[model samples]
Target: MGLVKIRVEGVSKVFGRDPAGALAKVRSGMDKTRLKDETDHVLGLHDIDLSIRTGEIFVIMGLSGSGKSTLIRHFNRLIEPTGGRILFDGDDILAYDAARLQTFRRRKVAMVFQRFALLPHKTVIENVAYGLTLDGVAKPEAFRRAGEQIALVGLTGFETSYPAQLSGGMQQRVGLARALATDAEVLLMDEAFSALDPLIRHDMQMQLKELQGRLGKTIVFITHDLDEALLLGDHIAILKDGTLRQVGTGSEILAAPADDYVARFVRDVNRGRILLCGAFADAGLIAAADAPVIAADATLESTFAAFAGGAAALAVRDWDGRIAGALTPRRVMEALARI
Candidate 1:
């Protein structure tokens, strides 16, 4: 059966007036509810509907204050919605009591914040073990599992070092390790690499993709960077002013944006690089033997040299070296011209 790991149905959250606080204000003659009616309060998130499939990397991208963080927080009930249903594996999370919510967070979901959030005094191993320790795992076993997690995130030699001793990238690795150590099925990352330098951030993105491929965990990543969204997402949702602009696979969004906002956002994207080479094909229209060959999955960066070699068409081969398609220079120019 196809399963949805997390489903958000018309979820909406508005701040500035808690139910208890509003009642208290009215009891004290503040008329807070009426005052709220007169004010232009911020809506952190409008009615949002989404479904994240199991084992997929779903990305939410938007400018700051566009509700990306608020929407992500709803997945794990970090911020309860003002209206609508959040279902985890088909169970409504809003129905959970405090204790059950804690259980759900500890066992089924884990979040990694942008700040790393590592305990300053704790060694990397202790930091990773903190969650299990809270659940009453034995010290030896917790440390053993923590070490394996540290190694999994590329922190093998730094297990005994304190957070302050590590570089920013290394510290973030510890944060990732802590999330992995929880053994949670769903991971929520809020701008996890935004704090790093470009080089470090690029490396971390690749590392995360590799780690995800091996682990196959369901992940929801939030970011404002278009390139990051393009690089890491299996499916992407673009948000503007607390509303969804578009949701689609990278190629789908690039090939045909849903509206003006999404089109403007990706106007400068190198379509040649982003579009799949296999997509530019006619079934059974393989290239001639004398044509230059490029891997079917090759990025535009890899195919540019072949395109400049004056061949009428280039042979596109899949991993098996069988002719899967052909790429024409005219098609490449056409795709690139869309930007």
Candidate 2:
């Protein structure tokens, strides 16, 4: 994890004519269901506290009405909280003036919506360059940057293609390219892949992971799908009923759920795919000199072929390249057997 890029403290949002009053009631121990029934005020979020690290994919996930989308919008101040403070790099963004906020939205953060909000008539390059043009960048410079982004997103030949002419996945690539063209430090993706077909969504997820590895943008990805969240997020925050349920790495949450709700949420997940070798490895055991080596962060599923090849045990090496421990085939099966 990098330095904290965005910090959300005591953030709560209520939607109604009497937002302040509703917030007060919420703080005074009114649950979301009762508050809504009594005041007709929807609790969008409740006391959300989060730290989004720089250059990491932070995923917020939940079912419908879980406030995942609401929480993400707070980062760019698209929707202000009724109470609490949002800080960007230790500076309170909630205090920004209109002009400062405009600059912050344009230069610091970019968003990719679920529906691929591209201009219908605009060509791919033009759509990608739209943000820069809004920032008063000259046409030539904006077009050049946009062209680079288009190519970066594997849409090199589609610069002149209109959104209507492109497939759903291609249109989404245009959305991503447009966000990247702005050179924003952070990317806010709200259900960005949810609109695509399953295969296309999987492809987009892989592309996003690859892009994050190379660009190192602080990405806040909102998804309702647990699989997508585990695949992309360096750290995942689970929300329920407008309240934060838990926040941790996917493996951490899988190994030890914060509560029964979280446990049930993760009950169907494939443990072998999420649990790391280091967590399951035996520190007391040592691997043979000829044993296969796997990274500590490698998923247990990735070691199956080695185990099938008659390797009784594999050496688990950490990120720093030191042998952390040895992972045996029996341990892998034991982990898979765990619900």
Best by TM-score: 2
Residues 70-189, candidate 2: write the lDDT tens digits: 999999999999999999999999999999999998999999999999999899999999999999999999999999999999999999989999999999999999999999999999
Clashes of each: 0, 0
How do the residues 19-113 of candidate 1 rate in per-residue lDDT, one tens digit apiece? 44443443455433453675434566666888899999999999998999989988888887777799999999899999998888888998888
* The best candidate in terms of lDDT: 2
- TM-score, predicted candidate 2 vs. hidden true structure: 0.96
Error of 2 at 273 (Å): 1.4
Give the range of the ten consecutive residues with the poorest summed lDDT in model 1. 19-28
Candidate 2 positional error at 90, Å: 1.3
lDDT of each: 0.84, 0.94
